[model samples]
Target: MSIQKEDIDHLLNLDKIKADEKNAHIVIDPDQCAACQAKPCLIVCPALLYTLDETGALNFDYAGCLECGTCRTICPHLKKWEYPRHTFGIYYRQG
Candidate 1:
């Protein structure tokens, strides 16, 4: 279940995002979220996109999210957040 170069390459190919590329289209809303007390997003996020700050506030690392939708589904509150840019977020392979 570890990541590899091909996974990264595949995502880049699909999203057309080159290495060291900038995905300005990627965005996340910390304030919009209710910051689920359980914070299941942290556990379910395969890419560890959801994390907490020193102050315990939600810190969203969009780049690491696999766009798995686990967070969206697990959240009792759907903040109606948008998906990562077409070529943005984490990429993966079966191997």
Candidate 2:
């Protein structure tokens, strides 16, 4: 069985998790990212942050993140993925 958008949306609706939206701890260098053909971050991100515009520019919103390092793990262009320095950045409700 497949988990539909509504299923994921329902899960998100149930989340009592808090996030620090001001500071986007995970930073991506656009220059380094430009060369990448396969952008796994857009697909792997649970929060639906990484996106592409009509002009093909990378649009990322690191708000309400799970901080699971899914983006970091998937990006081949990444030399080193940096997690949030602050401890209170991501608060997981269920997990």
* Candidate 2 lDDT by residue in tens digits, 29-81: 78877777788877788777777899887877666566788888787665455
Tell me the lDDT of candidate 2. 0.69
Q: Which ten residues in a row are the worst by lDDT in model 2?
A: 14-23
Q: Against the hidden reference, what TM-scores do the models get? A: 0.53, 0.70
Model 1 lDDT per residue over 22-87, tens place: 542234456545445677876776556566789888776555445567777777555454565554
Error of 2 at 33 (Å): 1.8
Clash pairs for candidate 1: 15-87
Candidate 2: residue 11 Cα off by (Å)? 1.9
Q: Which stretches of candidate 1 lie over 4 Å from their true place?
A: 1-35, 81-95
